[model samples]
Target: MTIIATLIVLGVLIFVHELGHFMAARSVGIRVDRFSIGLGPRVWGFRRGDTEYVLSAIPLGGYVKMGGMDDQVMERIEGGAVAEEEDGAAGEGKVQPGRGSADASRTEAVPSAAGRRRDSDFDSKPVWARAWVISAGVIMNMIFAFFAYTAVAAGWGSAQADTTRLGQVVVSFLPEGTEELEGVPEGAHFTRIGDRAVEHWGEVREAILDAPAGPLTFQWDNPRGEITVPMPADAEERRRVVMGLRYWVEPELIFVEPGAPAHRAGVRAGDVVVAVAGERVHLWSQVQDLIRASPGREMEVVVARNGEELSFSVTPSSVDGITPDGEPQTIGQIGVQAQNPPITYTRVAPLEAVQVGWSETVFVTGFILNFLGDLVTGQVSTRNLGSIVTIGEASGQAAAEGLPVFLSFMALFSINLAILNLLPIPILDGGHLVFLGIEAIRGRPVSAEQRMRWSQVGFFILLGIMALALGNDFLRLFGL
Candidate 1:
């Protein structure tokens, strides 16, 4: 299931990206030769007009072969026959969009003679035209994301976190044994977080949720001192474990995820938590601790559905996770979020959804850019780097949840794909843009030698990143 979901997701994103380039090229009169899906020798395809549309050996990404372009690095990346073009144009490889041979027996031609650069050739086009061709993929990905987000918003409504309301500020989590927190009560108010005066939950997300994983100090008035605790890097765990803001929290079940232990045990949203394992519980922290302590153990959960209390048996599932120590360990999971005192999910009109979608698109773009900057500046750990394995796992999980959730995940991933391609590294869409920019400013292209040298550097950098991400994935998989 994971593999299938991953493939489908990747295939859709890749197709949209490459299709952008293909359409842009044709619009600018650039004759495409080979339209290959994947990155190796032609597996199957048919010729149409001047392009030969074929499926290739590798099933990762697609490419198009355009006239008057020499992609040595791409050819090197793809290897073998994919590098050899029909017009003796060797080293003309595309990453996910490239060219091909036309049928001479029919009536179509290559759009020009094989020996000379034609007016329809990509190199013969204006700088703006070439730029359009190169950047179309990224643009399309962003557009796809926008539409997907808008659809989700229209269908399921946007999930706006309640930032103003305060509940269980300290009871959600209390660092026991810390000298400063020794006298602090369970429901004590927190005045500050990381030098920021947090009057509400908004600032908490910025100070703790958005901050990189590390030892962070907290001060409560009751204790009148500070205690340092390690924080998780991921957002999901940070909400539940670090902040204790789970739904069904506040002693009321606001959300009960389908197929989760709680839901399977017949728990539903709006159920007031009465007890767990027959032990009376009021604080979400106590509930979390109880559930965490009883991994894979069947226990009774009591909730107030109406005027009377109801009980159901649920067994917590154990999964690999981390704590403040950063060491991998088994922890119990019930798959739920919090329900505050009150909650609502109001579906928006199409127009409002569009506005919401645009806002989300811009916000996500900025957030990803900021995160990358942090990564470059060493504010975030490299251990957060993930590979295809992590994405596949997430794909499967999201799909299992439901369609709207799956689309939401896909939208986020598509935006990520677009942004990553805009990085100024060679061989990527961003790198080509850099080349074009240099050409436009200097009135000449960067010499092939220089381009090749930088491309090699870029390729190695990508290889290193891939290795690191794969390593992290394996470590997580094996509970390292």
Candidate 2:
């Protein structure tokens, strides 16, 4: 299931990206010789008109072969026989006569514009036309993400944090470093900040930040909770506090992976974990800590199910990982999910749904960009980088949840694909655009030797990044 879902998601995204390039080239009258969905030896294909459509063996990436593009070196990586594209126009330019499809295609060769140097060749096109062809792939990916998000919002509604209570008031997905938000008492929620009643954290932050630099009295729901906060005078500190606040999750199982140790031990979803190894646990973190400390050790687990206590003995799987400070370590996992703070779903009209979709797209785009920046600057851990392995795991988990969940994952992954391709690395759409920019300024394209030199450098950089990501995946899953 995981492999199937990962392939489907990647296949759809890659197809949309390559199709954008193909369409833009065609609209500009650039002759495309081949359209392929993967890189490597051709597994299957058929020629029609001037184009040979192929399904290649390697599924990591794909390409469109255009006339006048000197890609002999690229052929090594793309699975195109060296100089095959140049010979595409020499012979067999027409589809063979057939019963069902002969009428759908031209039976004769397409007329050449002139001996080899045709105006329809990619090199003959102006810089602007070439730029459009290069950029269209990223544009198409972003457009797909927007539509997917809108469809999910309109059909299944948007799910957002319902922070009306104390337990569900986490503000950030992951908090930042060198930051501590003290004096956040548990089991206490803000009844009012100043004279206004506050249910959301946004309201609480606004009231606190807008006030003068002084202690602010906060009214709480509990009788002994009229605590005063010595609000930070620094504006950035005020913002950081708002983002750092979070509550521990409840010790309830929301999911149990089929065939996992927990499931095999008769542990099921909706079970409220009460104790582990004879130690009482109230919060999800505590339950996880106990489990993580006992890898491959049979331990007693007590859960409250339907007002009756149940006991089960389960051993956790151990995997290698890095701690927050970058120390190598091994952690135990049982393939169970704790209930994340509850969410509320609301229906929206067509126009409202469109707005919601666009907003989500923008928000996710910014979030991804920020995380990438942090990862490079060492604010985020390198261990977090993932490859196809992690993606397969996530895809399977989402598929198990439901269609809406899967679609959300698809939308997010689409945006990620678009942004990654736009990085100013060689062999990517952004790299081609950079070359085109130089061509436009110099009134000529870069020499083929220079292009090849830079392209090889870009290829190595990408290879290194992929190796790191795959290593992280092995650490997370197989402890290799």
Angstrom error at residue 14, model 2: 0.6
Cα RMSD for candidates in order: 11.1, 7.5
User: Looking at candidate 2, what is the lDDT of residue 309?
Assistant: 97
- lDDT of residue 43 for candidate 1: 73
TM-score for every candidate vs. truth?
0.63, 0.70
Q: Count the backbone clashes (under 3 Å) in each candidate.
A: 20, 0
Give the per-residue Cα lDDT of candidate 2 at 193.
63
Error of 2 at 400 (Å): 1.8
Q: How close to the true structure is residue 472 of candidate 2, measured as C-alpha lDDT?
A: 77
> Could you give candidate 2's per-residue lDDT for residues 240-281 as a string of tens digits?
555554444788999886666788788999999999999998
TM-score of 1: 0.63
